[model samples]
Target: MLRDKAVTGMQLTLIIAALLILSSIGYAMGRRRAVAAGRGGALRLHSRPSYHGAYVALWCALPSLLLLVLWSIAEPRLAEWLLIARLPDSIRALDPDRLGLLVLDVKNLAVGNIVSREIDPALQAAAEGYNRFLTLSTAAMVVVAISIGVVGAARAIRGVSPAFRARNQVEKVARNIMLAASIIAVLTTVGIVLSLLFEALRFFDQVPFFDFLFGTRWSPQTALRADQVGASGEFGAVPLFAGTLLITVIAMCVATPVGLFSAIYMSEYAGPRFRATAKPMLEILAGVPTVVYGFFAALTVAPFVRGVGESIGLSVASESALAAGGVMGIMIIPFISSLSDDVMNAVPQSLRDGAYALGATKSETIRQVIFPAALPGIVGGMLLAVSRAIGETMIVVMAAGLAANLTANPLEAVTTVTVQIVTLLVGDQEFDSAKTLAAFALGLVLFTATLALNVVALYVVRKYREKYD
Candidate 1:
């Protein structure tokens, strides 16, 4: 089959491009109408004319865009059915798995992909016909959309009766759009929670919740054949919890003092010039990719930690929990510093002045007044940072070992829930296996933990916001 000059996605893109061009043309026409009215100085323009332009633009764009979204979603399903319906009875008679493979080959061949078999003319024609149908549909959509846009724009301009209330309509539309956009936050959270919940439910089906929760072993290996030798399928999460806890504690130890002090200095002690220079410099930390931090943890920080431990007459594993957590803490410092700084700065200047009037030093004013005023925001930011550290995967993956040794010792190599999840899902495995399902369980736990942290942080911030506002 000779492929079309334009693919389906590209065709849709061109139609969108045409719609934008038509919208621009409509805008220009509306502007011209406004100029003509102004020149005549007889019939007053009902609206500031740009509103008429935007009205036309919305007409030109919105319906077509909505149709495109709907069409794109439905096209694949309809096309698959169309192809499957045309398959020969012999091919259709194949088992489900084999039928899938046969369909794959037919699709590949229709796309001019090299196949061992000779050319199939029937399939090739079907593909070409499908392409033609799509192109005609696209062209028709664009033309109809533009025609409607032009007609609608002309009518709106002509019927801009006195008290047409163009501005009110425009404001009403914008308000509705803003409200819809705000719902995206809730939608995203809901989608993520639902996905994790479903997967965790699947995991729970394979491994009993009590076994996953209360059992002490952490082994995830299980044989495909039940008769196979030596395949222990233990599913305890205690070590992962312990490892995560130990690292999180070490990370807080490293991050809190450094981040809080830096924030304090920047907010309270630094000169205007110093604050300007330092704030961006500190935020640069947040922008640095976590992957770079992973390598730094594994290569640079791990060795230094081991050297320090050896000097102190202690044994430190090359891939110790401390190495990963310490680096992860450094990676998250900017989150604490930037957020705390904003909250501290938000504290009313009157409070600072009042404290100073009481003959307190700058340090005393900040420590007693500003810090307390900002404490809720500060705690919120800390909780946010802790959630970040807990969900962190890469630094731990590279620096922390895979052994699920349930130990509190930071110097010992330990694995986390995330690391085990990665290990379970790394290679190709049966999705139904306990190994693969275990990742979902781990993910569900992580999601639940982070969600809890966010709830607490929001509550704290909201309470403080109510007090101050």
Candidate 2:
């Protein structure tokens, strides 16, 4: 085995170095050819020189990498099967779990420092046999892969015929990679959806879906044993949705105007020095941790809200929903301001100039022209803010009462879906119970709601977005 390792070590390293150098040289040569053709002014060429470089790079790198990955997976499995077949009939007859441990020991003995006392003779022999196979197969694979890459690259270079299909071939590879990248995103979203779906199914098996959706009660306790005395678990979730909506409305009220005005001033009113210094400062609002916002809600904002409510002869809970929602609005202000500023800046300066030429004021041009052009981005930013508000957990948990109450009054304490999900999932509970599963259901609802909002925002932005050069 040591002999095999020594024989292959330098060969594999040299092969890898050669592949990199060869691909780089080939791409440079392809570019020179492309530039010569372009300068000759045939004016009927396929693509830019960079496209040719990228084209060769894809062919050179992708196939060999794929082969290496597949071999890495298959070679181990094949080696294990061959070694297992050599094990004595007695060891092979062991239960699967015990046999698995035995196989694990064999693998460790082959590669790791295993003292004789720790290894059985049968396992040590199996390890030796496996190591022999691995070293041999790995060297063969390295040689085969490098040879194929070099040969294919040589063929591509030789075929750099004036009418070479580099452009079409390169575009096709780019399209495939882009398609794969997009599918990865879709697969990620689908995986998230499936996880939520399964958890929701578990919850529904224990608690009726209708009651969870429509019933106003929100407690989630269940008996640890059949003999315990208590009311049956309260599993309704309508109150959570109500609290989420109320807090979101309050946050939107506070954030929309402040964020919009800040954006307008920054984009159209502030001088360059003020804009440069203040823009990043405003964005610092986003940098503040949610935990800091939680304390801000609990310590500062709650007391102030209570005091204001008291002055109006209104009774406010020590942890008012208003405080949490209000601070959340402050947290999201940057979202609206940053996006709206970009959209406003993108609007043609000529439109604003035309308005000024029509004797319109700066305010008039902004209100009539820039704001209209920026409205879609502003709305997209607002939808994102709304999603953030609904998902916020720490601020509401620290400042708002946990009691799940269905009410719209801003001064009243209310619980949100995220807060309830946290409460249910925090303390130790039986994993199989409805109480634990309910968190998953709540999570599914929250995910779906936000996903829907994002889709709608994307649709509106795509359809209504006005482009300017």
Candidate 3:
């Protein structure tokens, strides 16, 4: 069966290669004819010879590509239908899932893969039937696709003339393709939102929405058997929110001042040579993977924080939020710095000159002129950094232990919404239960929050932009 599938794939690939070759031939023919119709001068043509070539190429490729895509999508389901019909009545009477498993086994068996059950005469016969169907389907696809490509190319080539609007045709097709791509993206986002909403609603049905939103505890494990110990499925999300807020605040505290300062220095003070060197070095911090930061926090920062706390007679968890947040802040610094620097540099130099004309010192000029002018952009950058910190998972997962503590203290371990979402969905688990569905709920909430944050940021940016502009 595997050999048959491989052969079918090779045949399809060859069809695609042949279509491309035909398109290329059509392009050469169309260009030559357009030049001939224009009396060997492209200036006399209605459109450029290149446009004529592209028009012919698109004609040759699009129909065949569309056919190949449709065939690939429908081929498997059609194969399955044929196989099911070949199954014995007794086998067909099996439960839906069991029958599906049998189909899967037959496919795997035909491909020379090990099956769960022993190979029987019926299974062997079904596998053979499946191979035959696949071979016939692939052969049909090759014939139809090649024919479409050839016809499209021939029609396009024959239609080429000095008066032909090849540019308009090609541009219209390109515009339609782009519009289709955009619509697909919009529909995909809607699908995601609807999926999350339905799954979150299912979770809310099992667990009270108010409790999930406002309750302080967040134990999501519902005991399957009543006698199971330590399975109090209290799905309070307040603690998770609080932890996320605490860590975010801590990260901002570390990132904001440092990033802003670096931006100011680089934009207003540094020379061209120094700015070129320093900017890339600072931006390199952003390129360092979060996992590497996680390791640094876990192996180095966590221990150092613990030692400091101990010296001061204060207790610190092995996986403290302080360590995680601080490291996360370092990771986000480049985002704020790079953006803030660009914004500051964008401020008109005339403003600074006018400030200096008023006998303002360099510091005074920056404070009164440059700072105000760049404030909106700086705030936007900081908001982006905050969003980054909130969405960060690896650093928190590795350094801040998964203890959803509802406290402001950075010395204790705490978990964020992302961490909890990952935990709930990891490994094999029942999806119908509130536990699995909670991941969707968390994702929905996070999505809503990020959206709200973006909206607010945009408002602030616009307001400040008007004032500055």
Candidate 4:
């Protein structure tokens, strides 16, 4: 059993290493054969030696890798079916759920995990059989995979000739791989949208769509017992929407001007040395982790804001939206500054020269020509920053309290859609309940809102770009 366990652990690594070694050998052989074919200028090859090498390597590795993947996926299910088929008649005659639990116990016992039932003779025999099957399957996989790789390499090497279109074949394969990747990305996005839509539909069946959308309360706790408090939970999302908008507005107000002014200074006014030194330092803020930003907001910025508010005779919650929004704005500064600076720098030097030739000062040239020309990209950067602010979870979780108060006051405790989504889905959850499904509803709405924002931003960008052009 120990030997079987050791082999199972190391077999995958060994198989991959062996395949790599074979591919390297095939490449060397193919390149050598190509060079010999073109020796003494007797015949010119249609493709380069390197392309021939790559062709042989691809043939040597791709088939074996595919077989390995398929085998790994099928082996477990096959073994489990065989194990259940060989079980005792009494065990096989049990209910489906109980039989499944018994099989699970057998597997756990086989893997040295604590099993729920006693280790009887039947269970021990099943464990042994299971381990034996896995060992045999792994051994067969290694042999078959390597044998296929050798056959592929031999055939590819034999096919290599002066007239073989190795480059075209290799390029075709590369194009197919890229196309597959693009298809996978599109399918993945479609899958996400469908999953959210289906789950949110289920939630809407339980809670009215209008009530969820327009109600002011945000409590999601459902009572497990009839006499429990808050047996009927509110799913109104207006408070969450209000909080998201308030924080996003505050963040944009702080980020837009500071980030745009910084970009303008770095692009137009600062000397080369100063720009080079300051740009990286400013962009470094983006690399700082969000948890660190959350900590700073909770421990430092929140207290400072509360102190100032009280000094001025204003009420301030310990976890107000102001602190979270301010810190979030600071964290997103680099998104705007870096992108806007790059866009402004990309403006044609001829435009500046033309403006100066017309007797415009530096400031006048920037205001009249440069800013107008870069407005589209500047708006793009701000849109990206706004999206960042809306999606932020950690900062709001730490610095802003999870009280979904539908208020415009920044000094009050509030929570956004993302924060509520996290709150609803935390820990063990039953997916059939409205409490769990509400998270999906919130996610769908958030996705729609962001998509709408993107459409508007694109419209504004196109309009400005047409005017500038």
Which model scores highest in lDDT?
A: 4
On the 0 to 100 scale, the lDDT of residue 117 in model 4 is 88
In angstroms, the error of model 4 at 262 is 0.7
Instruction: Give the alpha-carbon lDDT of every model.
Output: 0.80, 0.84, 0.92, 0.93
Q: Look at candidate 4 and tell me the lDDT of residue 230.
A: 96
Error of 3 at 197 (Å): 2.0
Ranking by TM-score: 4, 3, 1, 2
Between prediction 1 and prediction 4, the one with superior TM-score is 4
- Tell me the lDDT of model 1 at 105: 61
TM-score for each of the candidates: 0.89, 0.80, 0.94, 0.95
User: For residues 386-468, could you state the per-residue lDDT of candidate 4 as single tens digits?
Assistant: 99999999999999989999999999989999999999999999999999999999999999999899999999999879243
Output the better candidate (2/4) by lDDT.
4
Worst 10 residues of 3 by lDDT: 460-469
Instruction: Identify the superior model by TM-score, candidate 3 or candidate 4.
Output: 4
Model 1 spans > 4 angstroms off: 1-6, 34-46, 80-105, 115-125, 227-230, 463-469
For candidate 2, report its TM-score.
0.80
Clashing residue pairs, backbone N/CA/C < 3 A, model 4: none
Candidate 1: deviation at residue 462, Å? 4.0
Q: Write the per-residue lDDT of candidate 2 for residues 61-103, one digit (tens) a residue.
A: 6677677778767877899898899999999999999888788
Prediction RMSDs, each to the true structure? 3.1, 5.0, 2.1, 2.2
TM value for model 3: 0.94
- Model 4 alpha-carbon miss at residue 370, Å: 0.9
